[model samples]
Target: DAGVTQSPTHLIKTRGQQVTLRCSPKSGHDTVSWYQQALGQGPQFIFQYYEEEERQRGNFPDRFSGHQFPNYSSELNVNALLLGDSALYLCASSLGLADNEQFFGPGTRLTVL
Candidate 1:
């Protein structure tokens, strides 16, 4: 079975632009969560999606939003990006309701110029 997958692995953008990163959950999983890991910091939860609706959200601004598809894949979109938004965007997957160990993908490193 395929593990979680994220892309494009690396990204570069300007401070005012927008970016959309993608993720495919591990096989047999139905919940997807997005995390932001700043340099030298632990991953901070952005939001979680299950059943195609947002189930949980973190202490982030409205600029961070996400979507989940029926197939269990997901996408994270950041609008009007700021330099502070430059970080490693990680996607984690869990089966059914959360609480189990989450499986993470190699994150997408975003750099805002």
Candidate 2:
């Protein structure tokens, strides 16, 4: 079975631009979560989606948003991007929120110039 997958292996943007990243969950996974990992830093939670609704969010601003589709795939949208937003966008998928096993994708490397 395939593991989680993300699109746009790399991206370049400028301040004030917007970007959308995609992710396909692993087989049998239903929950999707987004994270931002700055260079040399651990990931910071962006938000989580379950059952087609946003179930939980982290400290990120409203500009960061996401959607979960019926197929358990997901997309992350970032508006008014800033240089600070340059990082690896990671997607994680799990069977459920309470499940400890979460499979992660090879993150999309985003750069703001």
Candidate 3:
């Protein structure tokens, strides 16, 4: 079975642009979470999705949004990107909300120029 997967391993954009990143959760996993990691910094939780609904959110602006499909795949959309938005976007998958050992995909690196 395929583990968690993300598209466009790297991306570059200018301020004010919007970026959409994609993720497919690990097989049999239904919960998906997003995180942002800046240079030299640990990952910061962005939000989490389960049952096709957003269950929890992090300390991020409204520009960050996400969706979980029936198959457990997900997408992360960041609008009005700022230079500060440049970072590694990570996608994690688990069986449930209480599962602490989530499986993570290779992050998508976003660079705002």
Candidate 4:
């Protein structure tokens, strides 16, 4: 089965611009978690979605927003992007909210120019 699929492998935007990224979960997984990985830093938890609701969120600013659909697909939107917002956006899928096994998708590189 497909693990996960992400759109726009690479994107470039200037400050104050908005960007939206999408991710599709693997088969049979209902929980989707979004993460941001910056240069030389480990992935940071951006947010998580289960059953179409945000179950948890990280210490990100209000400019970051996202949603999960009934089909377990998710989209993340960042408004007024900053240079610091440039990072690799990724998504992980799990069977349930508490599931330990998470399969991660490839990262989508975002560059703020």
Candidate 5:
């Protein structure tokens, strides 16, 4: 989408490894949300960050952490990644927390080996 883009379009990691994914939000957007989509399933909310703080999180565990910079860009870090972590990671940008209109990035394909 025009408002959101992710880096390293694809990645490969092994079990027990850690990875960091990056996302740059829309020029005027102030919030970023991360999601994970496994094959044959809908995207699952991972977490949301705004104003440089994490305001909401989904069912993911603590191993999943994130940081939002002042520029509105954000990073998602997953530690001790498991095979189940293999999925498409998506980044969505919005104006505010849970905004009605969210521009989502194409997603970063992560395949765990």
Candidate 6:
């Protein structure tokens, strides 16, 4: 089975521009979560999607939004990017069960220039 995967491995953007990153969850999973990891900080949850709906969210601004498709793949869209938004965007997948363990993919390194 294919594990989680992300696109573009790396990205460069200017302040005020927008970027969209994509992710494909592991097979048989129904939940996808987006996380932002700063240079020296742990991953911070942005939001989670399950059943084509946002099931949980974090304290991030409205600029961060996401969507999950029927196949459980997802896309993260950030608007009005700021310098602070430059970080590693990680996509994680998990089954919607109580003992689910999230599996991460190689993140997309977003650079806000």
True-structure lDDT of candidate 2: 0.96
The list of candidate 5 runs beyond 4 A from truth reads: none
- How many angstroms is residue 88 displaced in model 5 relative to the true structure, after the best TM-score fit? 0.2
lDDT of each: 0.96, 0.96, 0.95, 0.95, 0.94, 0.93
Residue 50: error of model 4 in Å? 0.4
TM-score of each candidate structure, all chains considered together: 0.98, 0.98, 0.98, 0.98, 0.96, 0.96
Candidate 1 lDDT over 9-110, as tens digits, reads: 999999999999999999989999999999999999999999999999999999999999999899999999999999999999999764689999999999
In terms of lDDT, the poorest run of 10 residues in model 5 is 1-10
Q: Alpha carbon lDDT of residue 47, candidate 6?
A: 95
- For 1-113, candidate 2 gives per-residue lDDT tens digits of 99999999999999999999999999999999999999999999999999999999999999998999999899999999999999999999999989898899999999999
Where is model 6 more than 4 Å wrong at Cα?
none
Model 1 spans with C-alpha error above 4 angstroms: none
lDDT accuracy of residue 28 in candidate 6: 84
Clashing pairs in 3: none
- For residues 1-113, could you state the per-residue lDDT of candidate 3 as single tens digits? 99999998999999999999999999999999999999999999999999999999999999999888888899999999999999999999999999989999999999999
RMSD of each: 0.7, 0.5, 0.6, 0.6, 1.3, 0.9
In model 6, the Cα lDDT at residue 14 comes to 100
Measured by lDDT, the strongest candidate is 2
Per-residue lDDT tens digits for candidate 6, residues 1-113, read 99999997999999999999999998888899999999999999999999899988999999999998888899999999999999999999999935369999999999999
Q: Which residue pairs in candidate 2 collide?
A: none
Residue-by-residue lDDT tens digits, candidate 5, 1-113? 35688988999999999999999998789999999999999999999999999999999999999999989999999999999999999999999985899989989999999
Residue pairs whose backbone atoms clash in candidate 4: none
Q: What lDDT does model 4 reach?
A: 0.95
